[model samples]
Target: MFSILIAGRLPQINFQQVSETQFVIPISDIDHVNHLVVFMTGQIPFPENYGGGGNWPSAEGPSWIFLGKITNVKPSAIFKIGKIKDIESKIGSSLAPTLFSGFQHQTAIPTDGLLGISVEPLSQLDQQIQPHDITPSTVASNVEFVSKMLNNFVNYVTSFVQNVPGTSEQIVPLSIIQTWYNNFQRRITENPNFWR
Candidate 1:
């Protein structure tokens, strides 16, 4: 069961080409958008400054919508992997892919891309999402935030393992690690308190 984080109808949107590879569009929304990028590419739409110089759309300003559409369909693992690759290529980030249960076992040490196992559910917004721009600094911060969340999840599992009987001197089994990771991932997705 996958739910798109962003989905909805965008009203009064206008697209303009700014360069060979970039575009600018104005949107109407009443909030600050987060984590929304061009579908499939994870390309953050640059927020056009109007009336003020905020990086995101405020209740009083115009939200800039970009080309490309996010969909409601659940993305297959391969599709998600491709999207991640696209993002890494565009940002020059080296990302590795990881999968948990209910899928093929693929493992690679993360170097630049996202820790795929911890990826949140992605989807198109049914309504226009709040306008926001993606910046290198914010991307770095998001990575750091994910790392912190994973660390917290690890600590949570460690505490649980410590309570297991007669397991103090034994190696933590891979199955147990995977199970805990899945639980952590689910919790984070269901409740994105980490974003706050």
Candidate 2:
């Protein structure tokens, strides 16, 4: 991924393309990634950026809506491993597939119930890499921010069809998502080689 990326642009494209013949990358080392390249084959850019162009007809008209279109991405297990200093365990090539998401939801139920895991405390990891000069209010905000991230990640992982029997909406545990995140951080710190 980085190989193709480095061949393209700069910070706009985070990759380390060596030559035409070789491109080495460590596997599953990163914990998070922001505005980074997800997939890179031969410079064509794998998935489509957005499906059907413009956001016209604010009101629902006689149009073919893309209901649950993006079922899954190509490369299966996402996440290449690597750390970028302050942002340890950042996402790498493995996450390249997810970059295509935009206005979507889970269609198929998960294989496991996220294994029913709990959100392990990452305070130790936090202590190891303390954020700089945080204010008192920032503490609360940061916690809330972490909570939201956990929320999104939870929504991502534990998506399985479980009938409520009474209610219309299905259910999935957020704790499992939290666990995934915690484990991800642990893995990133442990190996720190998925994305070398």
lDDT scores of the candidates, listed in order: 0.32, 0.29
Query: Candidate 1: where is the Cα deviation over 4 Å?
Result: 1-133, 138-143, 162-168, 187-195
Worst 10 residues of 1 by lDDT: 50-59
lDDT of 2 by residue, 62-138 (tens): 12111111111332112211222223224332321211122222213232100000111233212221112111225
How many clashes in each structure? 17, 24
Alpha carbon lDDT at 161, candidate 2: 39
* Model 1: per-residue Cα lDDT at residue 157: 63
Off by over 4 Å in 2: 1-156, 159-161
Q: What global local distance difference test value does model 1 have?
A: 0.32
Q: For residues 1-196, what per-residue lDDT tens digits would candidate 1 score against the true structure?
A: 1112223653212333333332333332323333333322223322232111111211112322111232323222211122322333432221111112222122232222111111222322222221122222367767877788778767766765534566556345677778877876675444434344
Instruction: Name the lDDT of candidate 2.
Output: 0.29
Q: Could you estimate the TM-score for every candidate?
A: 0.28, 0.21
